[model samples]
Target: MNPEKALVWFRRDLRDHDHAALSAALSNAGQVYCAFVFDTDILDALPSRQDRRVHFIRESLAELDTALRARGGGLIVRLGRAGEVIPGLARELGVASVYANRDYEPAAKTRDIAVAESLRAQGIAFHTRKDQAIFDGDEVLTQAGKPFSVFTPYKNAWLKRLTATDTAEWQCQGAFAPGPAEGIPPLEQIGFMPTDLDTIGIQPGMSGARALWDAFRAGRLARYAALRDYPAIKGVSYLSVHLRFGTISIRELARAALADESHAWLNELIWRDFYFMILDHFPRVVGHAFKPEYDAIRWAERPDWLAAWQQGRTGYPLVDAAMRQLNYSGWMHNRLRMVVASFLTKDLGLDWRLGERYFADQLNDFDLSANNGGWQWASSSGCDAQPYFRIFNPITQSEKFDPDGKFIRRYVPELAAVPNKYIHAPWLMGRLEQEAIGVVIGRDYPGPIVDHTQAREETLARYAVVKKTG
Candidate 1:
């Protein structure tokens, strides 16, 4: 029995085609209305008025609304807390059911529960379907019927359990009810302002995702595994923001990875699912360490060092370059993310939470599970994480990844005059060499804040508490 009227509440999944919840609504309901909420609960909490993510979402919603209009429907946008807005909208629409894609974050889950309870009280059903991940929760557990804590075996199991149907599109059909004449609100209306998204070379919406995917598949996918590590190369797909907002489909991405046998890219996607699973099973990792013993390790309190690192004045070229890129563009290369995380947690001896929180604020593609997982992995306090003693050497990392200093020069322009040999460690240059380059260590560029050798030793001793606690 299909509901006479149903409303599809758009959340992260913003696209029209191949949407699970949208398809479910169209399939099960006689008449379907589409809606998106500005979600003041989230928008109000943003630290910045000029957030790139907010701009991205705003633009994406415009495209989504247009797409829905073409399909004889339009997006009914509202501005309020989603828990109240969704139920109230359902009541106003006189709908029997409301559909949405499931969100895995703890806060989202809580909000969904409240919305469901409210909807239930109004004699309206709230339904959520999985659209974010190809496999979610217990879908691909171990033979023991328990979620796997480690990644490698889980990847193997995930691959083994994969079938054609998993990546198949949830076809959206049936008529759509046209929304009100007024479309999505402006940035100012939502209490946000325009960001540098245009200048930073990011394109939003399904069109943007399609463009990036086409470019990656046409040129970079084959060489992705080989060239992805270098920050200077256009080797990896820049579809993370789309993935974060659900403008792109995970199933579509997985299908491409599987078809092309691009194991490297596929592995990265698997990591996303792995982190989501980790967050699902161990919500405690939100603030604490996944490996509980690691939480016993005391981190140093150095406000100066923390500020230096955040401001990209760390005196380490690669670390500074990475931070500068993030601060400037609101995006960081995947490899640089690891390098900077290691530098922050291992070299600077700051808490991983600080870096994680900073990333959560800065990244345009900030997904809670992945951001938290990466920080925990770098700090060696996560499941299947690297050993604590495996600290990244900033200079070596720079030399290996940005050998010609192209990436460094782009972000840290003061180092543009430094030669290749001394680029990775300008402070190591002779005074005469620095003079020849017309750059002084402390004047033009900051010198290294902490010695790598000393920091590494301190990190080892600091992590010894983990072993002691065990």
Candidate 2:
């Protein structure tokens, strides 16, 4: 039996197609109304008014609204806490049900529960569907029905469990009920300012996602495994922001990866699902270590070093360049992300949570699960993490990945004249060589903040507590 009237409360899933909640509403209801809340519960906590993510969402919403209107419906947008706004809007519209895609973040899950309770009180059914991941919850559990903590087994299970129907699009068959004529509000109207999204080469809507996917499919997917680790080349898809915001469909991407037999790229997508699964099964990883004994390790209190890392003045060329790239562009290459995270936790002796929070603040495609997972992996605190003894040599990573120093010079331009011989470690240059290159180590490019050899020994000692307890 179809519902008389239904409302679709859009959250992270922004697009009009292949949307689980939207398709369910349109298919099951006589008429459907769509709305999106700016969510002050989230917006209020943002540290900056000119957030690229906010701007990206605003632009994406405008396009979504336009797309819906073409199908004889429009989007209703509001600015308030979703808990209050969704129920109130559902009541006013006289909806029998409210449909939405599920969110996995602890805060978001909590928010959804409150909203559901409110809707239930008003006699409106609250239905949620999975739209973000290929598999979530216990769908991809182990043979004994327990959640898999390790990724390789999880990936094997994820692939083995896949079928054509899993990647099929959720078609919207029923007609949409027209929304209130008031359109989407501008960024300023919603208490946000325009950002350098255009300047930074970020194309924010469904159109942008399609363009990037097309380009990557046409050229880069074949060589992604070979060239993806190098930060200097365009060997990877820049579609992460689109994926984060649901401007593109995960199923669509997975299908393409499978069709092209690009197992490496498909493996990355599977990792996304794995992180979501990890967060779902082990929510405690949010604040504390996944392996509890890791909490005993004492992190250093080096405010100056922390500040240097954040400001891209760490003096290690690769680390500095990666930080600068993140600061300026709001995106960092995957390989550089690992390198910088290792440098922060292992070399600088800081807590992984500190680095996790910083990446959460800066990354354009910041998914809490992936951010936490990567940080934990680097710090040897989470499931299937690297051994604590493994520390990245920033110079070797730079040399191996950016052999010509192109990436370093692009972000840390003070070393523009540095010869290839000393480019990876400008501090290694003799004074005469530094003079010839016009890059004095201290005055031009700062020297390495901490000696790698000394930091490695310190890190080993610091993690000894974990070893003893384990």
Q: Choose the strongest candidate by lDDT.
A: 1
Over 223-323, each residue of candidate 2 has an lDDT whose tens digit, in order, gives: 99999999999999999999999999999999999999999999999999999989988899998999999999999999898999998998998899999
Candidate 2: lDDT of 141?
88
| TM-score of model 1 (CA atoms) | 0.99
**Model 2 error, position 333 (Å):** 0.3
What C-alpha lDDT does candidate 1 achieve relative to the native structure? 0.94
Candidate 2 has a TM-score of 0.99
Instruction: Write one digit per residue (lDDT tens) for candidate 1, span 1-470.
Output: 46489999999998999999999999989889999998888988999888999899999999999999999999998999998999999999999999999888999999999999999999999999999998898998888999888899999999998999999988999879887899889999988889878899999999999999999998999899999999999989989999999999999999999899999999999999999999988899999999999889899999999999999999999999999999999899999999999999999999999999999999999999999999999999998998999999999999999999999999999889999999999998999989998989999999899999999999999999988887
How many residue pairs clash per model? 0, 0
What C-alpha lDDT does candidate 2 achieve relative to the native structure?
A: 0.93
